[model samples]
Target: MTALRPAPALLEAAFEAAREAMVLCTADRVVVMANEAARHLLPSARPGSPAPAPLPADGADSFQAEHEGRQLYGMRRELDDGHHAWFLRDHTEELARTTALEVERSRTAFLAEAGRRLSASLHMRRCVRTAVELAATHLADAAIVVLPPERRQSAWTRLLPGLPVEEGTLREPQLGEVPGLLEALGGFPPIPSRWLDPSQAPGWLVPAGFGPVGALLVIPLPGNAEPAGALILARCGPAAVFTSEDEVLARIFAARAGAAVSAAVLYREQVDTTAILQADLLPPELPEPEGFELTGAYQAAREGLRIGGDFYDVFGPAGASTDTVIALGDVCGTGPEAAVLTGKVRQTLRALRLVHTEPAAMLTVLNEALLQQSSRQPRFVTMVIGSVHRIDHGRVQLELASGGHPAPLVLRHDGSVEEVPTSGTLIGVLPRTVVRPATVELAPGELCLLYSDGLTEARGGPTGTEQFGEGRLHQALSECRGMPGAVAVERIRQLVSDWVRGGDSDDIAMLAVRAPTRTPLSLRGGGAPAQSPYVIAARRGDRRPRNF
Candidate 1:
């Protein structure tokens, strides 16, 4: 306050020597002073010229502005005389660094999203296509190729954008040359690439600016622990060097892709194997029976992993006879265990037939044997065994026994359907229970139908709980009355299939027997005296008096 001393010119000159641009302006936008940098930026600075338009206000200390296409940051302060002093700094390098960081962040976000989408897709073909598209879009590759394992003379090959590949043109990879690349990536196998030997590479190189083939990734697909296929990726483009990040990403994606392809191939193989086993278990065709015509069909349940135990057998004459036997049975459970039980039951039943003419006795013996031989597993079987005998002309007798099975439906010539109810508990439930036989007399042109529970228990109708019960079955049988046994059985099967509409939860086994209108004896006798029913005496254990 004593004597105002003018600022030294040296102070101004020293400030001009600094790197940042500096300037001084009055509140009314008048140029007062400027540093060398500011003078260099303008090139129009005069000793006392007016300041540029849009001068900064007092206390606006930090802000950005553009000058001659260059960005500048500045701070302003108020002077004692209501004037303003502004200081400017160039921020070009800082802005450039910030922009580069943002770009990298966006790239990382895109790669993360792409990887998630690739892993989530369940369809193998769609996942492969998406991966290829990702490589082409992000990695800037010239082409992407995937080769599956060799099968027969050819391996499966798919190129991105569907590049046309000539038949038998793709060759297998040589693994020995690329040991270093495979060793660097743990658990990754080498896929033979055509470019390994420069001479074998395609003539079409990438454009001049684009780079060489940077890397090849190979992944092995193991199906049920057995090598089933492989996935290969070829990357080439400008700046196409494979970074450490790329190797990590490719390794993860390849593992996921290999697993998906393996699952699909294994599923296909299992389906084929099951179908073959089912075919082997089923009979080629039922034998033609004589007075009574017989037709039988067997089908395995589709949902079960193995063939079911539903089976039908017609033994003896097709005609009505005291000895003709028709048997339909369903063993408990499904698959291999049930199939083995079915074989045992069939063998036992056949053996019992030699000693017992009555169906009930034969079933009792079979049940006892099954209970004794089978493990104490909670299992049982349903069966319907029937014997047809001709008593006199125009009369055929049917003796039936049911073991917890659906009663056989009898279709008469008069278009009426009747269910023949037989009494017996399920076999293998009670070791010594006796089965009760029911008898029916068949008239000329009448049919008898035997079926497993699969036909009646099929889901259908409203409530989604309604079953194709006995009523529907009877109606179907009545509709097919007087038809040939083979034709009638086939119609019944079709009607059941339609009612179920293919919703068969269990296996179906059916057998149909129809007494022919003409007697077998009449056919053999040539309209003369009929011979007696052929008799084959069964043997019994000798019971001579034992020595005391």
Candidate 2:
């Protein structure tokens, strides 16, 4: 046999010199050899029984091996011979770094999710609670507090786990009360009090038996121009010092929190203001038409930090012997300005009734007034005006004039919706123009629906690909043919709300009036004429004055 020139011993010595633990085992479960690293790692290695089963079959060459209290790793390879070799490598430091990375990733994910939740939440209390919990669990051992402008004491406070206990502590300073601190820091930037030793600062005070405070982090809750409140954190243990990295993360979180709070506050205020203005602008109750029962509802868009301009008004007289008129309009903007304009339009329409009796003529006059008033601004208004005249017997005559508004929808008793043929230019665009009002004869039980653009312009579907157009409105009205006007209006509101998924981009105003056939006068005959008694009385009384 050719001499095997001591290759096995040399190879064994080379393997022993390597830093990685090395072991060679035969297929029959007998240990062929083991290097110094392998010997050091496994003190019990004689001729191993199974060679620790070649690290898991996956391609990962290195993995942990927890033997006793210490952690290690075993890398494996198949030798040129049929034997298998395992190289042991300690991985304690690498594992520590990987664990830290994973923790940081989890923290980032948690913060992102918290921000989304805060943005979506409508209730301020719940949002504040959730935010505090998120920061306490993920960011640091913090005490979150929110203070309202009216509340002399702090708004709320949530103590994080492991914080020093303070009982009945009702007084805390809000950022509004600390203008000096905020101005000193320039725009209320976050400041770390940990740098100043707790014992050195005169303001640092510890509770009964608690140890000296380790760190303090103060962040201001910002609003339109100034800080609204302050977020104060107190730490106790040696590891509680607020680091620069911690301050950076806190500032980011504070920014999101401040924005969410500001948005919510603004939304609530706008809603209140809009509701008040809309209620004030619209008449409390519509005048009863001679042959009609009127029911109406108005809704503002659920968007932005402003109120919209959608309004409905009913003028003229009440009862069977009276002429009832209805008007619905939308201003082209949002917020207090639009609300102001809406109020003006309603007032103008009401005032026009004193001079004009014709619906089209009254709209024309109001249009001129609006144009004169809004000449300096680059906006216009759309309106639909209607007058109901009780004709002889149970029949009623409806006259409608549209100014760049959606055509009124008429629902017949037979479940058919007809888009009324009424179209004209928007008001406030022309200084003087003739408005031709369309006339329609309504039988008993027929209903008319007048609405603004909000219902027709709602974005549809998951991607907002479609709009709840005029066709959809017609379909919805047709579906509720036999329902009462009040019920129908409610259903329409519900349908619109659902189609928009609680998100509306524009303001919606709707008014529905149903012409009832039977008159109270039919039960009793001495009733006056359907024409205004005041006008007739005035005409009779004016004969002597005209003669003079």
**Index of the highest-TM-score prediction:** 1
Q: Per-residue alpha-carbon lDDT of model 2 for 1-548, expressed as tens digits?
A: 98767687697688778887777766554676777777776765557555553344454556776765446777667766677767777666788899879877876887688788888876666666666766676666655545443544446556557663232223444342332333422345665664445444223233434455567666776655655455555576766687777777777776777667767667778878777765766445765554668888876664543346888888876344356777888898866678888888878877776555566776787777776774468567888888777665455667788888888887876777776667778888877665545766555667889998888888865666478888888899998877888989999888888887865468888898786744566575757634311111121233121110
Candidate 2 wrong stretches, greater than 4 Å: 1-123, 151-153, 159-216, 222-224, 236-252, 259-292, 297-311, 316-324, 328-344, 354-360, 370-432, 435-548
TM-score of each: 0.60, 0.51
**Model 1 / residue 20 / CA error / Å:** 6.9
Q: Candidate 1, which ten residues in sequence have the lowest lDDT sum?
A: 532-541
lDDT for model 2 comes to 0.67
C-alpha displacement of 455 in model 1, angstroms?
4.1
Candidate 1 lDDT for residue 464: 46
TM-score computed on alpha carbons, candidate 2 = 0.51
lDDT of 1 by residue, 143-230 (tens): 3333342542223333433343212223434322332222322334544442243223343222333345555554454334554444
Cα error of candidate 2 at position 434, Å: 3.1
Off by over 4 Å in 1: 1-154, 160-230, 236-240, 280-326, 331-369, 372-376, 386-401, 419-423, 436-445, 454-472, 484-509, 515-548
- Lowest summed lDDT across 10 adjacent residues in model 2 is found at 532-541
